[model samples]
Target: MVAMPEPSAPLSLRHRLAQNLRRLRLERQWSQEDLAERSGLHHNQISMIERARSSVGIDIVEKLMAALGVRASDLLD
Candidate 1:
């Protein structure tokens, strides 16, 4: 199993993105499949992103932002 980071430890950009993505998705009442369909990505891709198991390119980020009706900064910061 993968180890989880300590709560006190600062998250890396990838992990921060993952956390924010999941939060935003949930706030919108969307499942991974829903996000994937809206983003034109596969559900597996969304899962990987939410888990921080995949490094996303700017194009993918743009897709997600558009699908989620959020800005790039919302996902990053």
Candidate 2:
């Protein structure tokens, strides 16, 4: 029988990005669906990204920046 490895802690970048995104969305009082519509992405995809289930690449980060009216640096914070 093979055993599965325990999940490691999330990377700081992932945690920072996810936290910043959530904070931004909440500041604007927008739902995941709202961000999805603005970014031309699926709601579930946004959910996944916010939850760090999906890796966020630069392209998606640019899209999110545009949708949220934030600079990429904002997410880094």
Candidate 3:
């Protein structure tokens, strides 16, 4: 039987982005649902993004940046 490889640690960049995104949302006192409504995205999607479980798209990033009033670089940083 082929053994499955162990999972590696999550990327720091992704983790950092997740942390930053959550911080930004909390800074504005916005819930995932609130941010979802503002960004025209699903709350589940926002949850996935914040958890770094989903790959972020440019469009979603733009929407988040707009909704959160932050620059793309700021969030990614």
Per-residue lDDT of model 1, residues 6-63, tens digit only: 8999888888889999999999999999999999999999998899889999999999
User: In candidate 3, which residue ranges exceed 4 Å CA deviation?
Assistant: 1-11
Span of 10 residues, lowest total lDDT, candidate 2: 1-10
Query: Tens digit of lDDT per residue, candidate 2, span 4-25?
Result: 2345854467767877898999
Top of the candidates by TM-score = 1
Please tell me which model should have the higher lDDT, number 1 or number 3.
1
Q: What is the TM-score (0 to 1) of candidate 1?
A: 0.93
Relative to the true structure, how large is the alpha-carbon lDDT of every model?
Answer: 0.93, 0.84, 0.84
Error of 1 at 41 (Å): 0.4
**Quick one: RMSD of model 2?**
5.1
The Cα error of candidate 3 at residue 11, in Å, is 5.0
Q: List the residue pairs that clash in candidate 3.
A: none
Q: Candidate 3, after superposition: displacement of residue 77 in Å?
A: 0.5
Runs of candidate 1 with Cα error greater than 4 angstroms are none
Candidate with the larger TM-score of 1 and 2: 1
Clashes of each: 0, 0, 0
State the lDDT at 23 in candidate 2: 91
